[model samples]
Target: MQNRQQSEIVRDILTVCNGSGTTITNVMFHAYISHAQARGYLGELIDKGLIENDIFDSRQYRSTPKGLKYLAGLETMSELLAIETRRIAKSGANIC
Candidate 1:
């Protein structure tokens, strides 16, 4: 894959939560992001109402419905991109 986009990173973060809750450390490791990057994205996600701090577990985070919706959209886009990529590769067409 090419350089990861912020949306992709956010989607990864949301997916990692699994509705149970997850920590910044978990997201950083799973998403292959640095702590600082995780922190920044976490804050942004919280502000956007896509993620929220766990009430019972202050250190953990849970995904909101909006975050799940966004994650689903990203998955769809990724699948479409993969299909296009395979079609181009089969046809020997340049993506550039």
Candidate 2:
């Protein structure tokens, strides 16, 4: 897989936790990251208050309200970028 940006990885993590609380292994597998990488990013997400360590299940991670908002914003920006990219590609072809 292509190397994704930090924001992209974080977005994926948020998505992974969106439906339910998940273990580090689930996040790592779903996000396609190694254990070391998962630890680092998960820690960062928790630090950023984007994810919360579930008290009832210490091993699980859940997305915070802020994380859900971030995910929504990221999806919006990606959609906008895709639209702009398609428009530019079409215009460039016309110029040729």
Candidate 3:
């Protein structure tokens, strides 16, 4: 399996919780990260105001509007990079 970047993992987590709140376990599973990683990321995201713990259920987390914006930006960057990669391939240019 190819390793994903931290930003990609963050995006995955945000996507998972964007519509409805989800537990940390769901975030870990969906982001393909370990428990420790999930905890760390969740803490950081919460601190950054990108995610918030549900008031009714602290175990559940949901993405904030800022997080959605961040996710959108990351998705756009990924798409642009993929397009550049395809263009380079067509031109027979090495990316690395």
Candidate 4:
């Protein structure tokens, strides 16, 4: 797994792409992440063979099988955390 920031950026991009094909500009703007950071994240994902670029549309990117696996893992973790939070709430445990 990558560092938190990189993982988060990749996850955000994947989510955006899964919903609707996104341009680099939209990813940077909507995700509230820096342009450099977004570009860096994309580059890393591409290098890792986790994403592929659409040459017909230079800005278009799509997640590969590896990327999907990573996203699924992240989603699983998120769901687990949500479930744990609910359990804690039900137990009257103060999270803060």
Cα-based lDDT for every prediction: 0.81, 0.82, 0.85, 0.70
Error (Å) of candidate 1 at residue 36 is 0.6
TM-score per candidate: 0.79, 0.82, 0.82, 0.70
Better of 1 and 2 by TM-score: 2
Q: What is the C-alpha lDDT profile of model 1 across 1-96, one tens digit per residue?
A: 456667667777888975799998999987778999999999999999989999988899989998889889977886667634332465787643
lDDT for model 2, please. Answer: 0.82
Which candidate's lDDT is highest? 3
Query: Residue 8: error of model 3 in Å?
Result: 0.8
> What's the lDDT of the predicted structure labeled candidate 1?
0.81
Sort by lDDT, best first: 3, 2, 1, 4
Q: lDDT tens digits, residues 1-96, model 2?
A: 445677677877898988679999999987889999999999998999989998998899999999999999987886665633332454674322
Tell me the tens digit of each residue's lDDT in model 3 across 1-96: 456667878888898989779999999888888999999999999999999999999999999999999989987897777633322455787543
Rate residue 65 of model 4 by lDDT. 78
**Model 4, span 24-89: residue lDDT tens:** 787786556788878987798789887778768867877777888889997787666653333345
lDDT of 3 at 1: 48
Best by TM-score: 3
